[model samples]
Target: MTDSPNSATAAVTLVSGPAGTGSIDDFELFYARRALGRFRARLGRQGLLDLLAADIDEGNAFLRESARASDGGYTGGTTVLSTQGLGAGEFVAWMDKAFADENVLLAAQPEHYLMVGQANGSVHVVENVGPHICSFYLGDWAAEAMAWADDADELLPKADFPYKKATNLFLADGTIVGRVLIQFGETDDGFTSSLTVYLPASCPQDVLDHHLRHFAVEFRNWITAAAAARA
Candidate 1:
């Protein structure tokens, strides 16, 4: 098992799992086996999520700022990293509910945004951003995000920065509660990279924490399952 030198509080690890060698040179090994075991033993489900969210949030802020300065200036494409501690479905559902019936969050710019439904997916448009400020909805955002995280080629160049990577963290219920977008530049020394985590202000801390724990446990199981499938 190799421990990823992150922060003092969050000790992420990569361990050799059943799935062949269980090493994605691209990603730091999933939380270390020993570290995860200890963490699990130490906290409840909610506690785990809280810790993960905090760590991810911190990582997001640092990465976004770093990306802005990576080339001595903002890259200007998609410079932000939006990550959350919820699954795609959950997040979508939440958005629908939040925007449903015009309940909370005073809508000051409903006219600025438009939603267009298509047979295959949906299209979201922001009027102020220009005619091209639109995105097509696709299947399983969580799955797509995970694929993007795992492979640079699978990344969405149209929606993301030119030299960036997006990754998703999944829970046991298959809910992706965390994602990171990292921008990198090739240089003589190697690659300069910056990361960002997406967090929604509407989400309550407790709700976020609950989901974080769910992901923590599920992630451990996922690693094992992935290894077994590959093996």
Candidate 2:
């Protein structure tokens, strides 16, 4: 367990588990099972597949690029952060809005997302993780995620898991390089979030570690921004 650099009013603890071991397909399947099970249960088998297919069609530029770049390998880590006075719902809304504004996104994690520029509907982000300027489909799966969070059935209630959002990363040329999956659960005083970053398996250990730290730093700052918005 390690603490990332944070503001005086924010407490963000990051615990990085072992790097994922497997081919890129294995990595994708692992996360799909963990993150999409509830959606499957709610959407039914065929419905879930349809939703996924639609999402892929809408924003698969990165997927196309990743296939060309990753060479059948991938690595990633999850960082868990617990903080006070911010609910999962509030943070999710703020995050969605922040992505639309390059300034807000960069402000939240300047150390990691050094620069953010608009390219078509996606954002081209320059980060400390690598030398390339990455392109990300910020709203990828966002609508579906919000819908899932809002629709709570008797079998799977919202009280159990409050919010979730998944988006992807790509190179400027459209090759997929990484992904981000965030799940947030409400706590007594605030919330706990699991921030996961997936990179091509060939990424160095230091780069993977830096990404975990990057998640910690950016999210801590975003929590502060969300709190200020509420005020």
The lDDT of each candidate is 0.35, 0.60
> 1-231 in candidate 1: lDDT tens per residue?
322223256555676655555545433434444454455447643464464555434533433333344432221122322332323233334344443222121122321222333353322222211111211121333334455454443244432334543444332233333344544343333223233433233333443343333333333332233333335
Instruction: Output candidate 1 Cα RMSD.
Output: 17.5
Residue-wise C-alpha lDDT for candidate 2, range 1-231, written one tens digit per residue: 333334355554434555855655456656765554445357653463354454434334434544557784566588889988888888888877776665566565543333344555555554455323333434353525434224322112347555766666665455666666677888898888887777777555666787788788788878988899889
Task: Say which candidate scores most in lDDT.
Answer: 2
Q: Which stretches of candidate 1 lie over 4 Å from their true place?
A: 1-35, 52-54, 66-231
Q: What lDDT is reached at residue 90 by model 1?
A: 33
lDDT of 2 at 216: 85
